[model samples]
Target: MAWGLAEFDAERRGKKEGYSAGLSDGISQGIQQGISQGAQQKAIETAKNMLTFGDSIEKISQVTGLSEEEIKSLIK
Candidate 1:
């Protein structure tokens, strides 16, 4: 029947819309995670450089926003 067809079409459309929204959200989250990881890596690299220059662990932690333990790990 025409009504049954209409219902089916609506259901399919809803599923498509839901999938699109989920995919968009997933991409956005992935991008944010990548950016965060990249920033963290940069901070670590900077901390290592500071260490090479004989900077104190506390100073590196303050400047790079990393923990003193993390800076100490880089020393090894």
Candidate 2:
């Protein structure tokens, strides 16, 4: 009876560890996705601000550190 209980405990511990690993991976992935999305949004807003400030596309590219093609795409 004691051996059976020990085996059950070990199985339960293994399941808990698997669940913990999965949760950690999910949280990390979600955080990375959020950060990437935030950066894209910030870039778009910076481009818009530069346009409002009367800067040319080249100037906007220089100021925002975005590529010329990206700035042009934003303008469209």
Whole-model lDDT values for every prediction: 0.94, 0.87
lDDT of each residue in 9-75, candidate 2, tens digit only = 9999999999999999999999999998898788879999888787899877777778889888877
lDDT of each residue in 1-72, candidate 1, tens digit only? 456888999999999999999999999999999999999999999998998899999999999999999888
Q: Where is model 2 more than 4 Å wrong at Cα?
A: 1-3
Instruction: Candidate 1: list runs displaced more than 4 Å.
Output: 1-3
Evaluated at residue 17, the lDDT of candidate 2 is 100
For each candidate in turn, the TM-score is 0.94, 0.74
lDDT of 1 at 31: 100
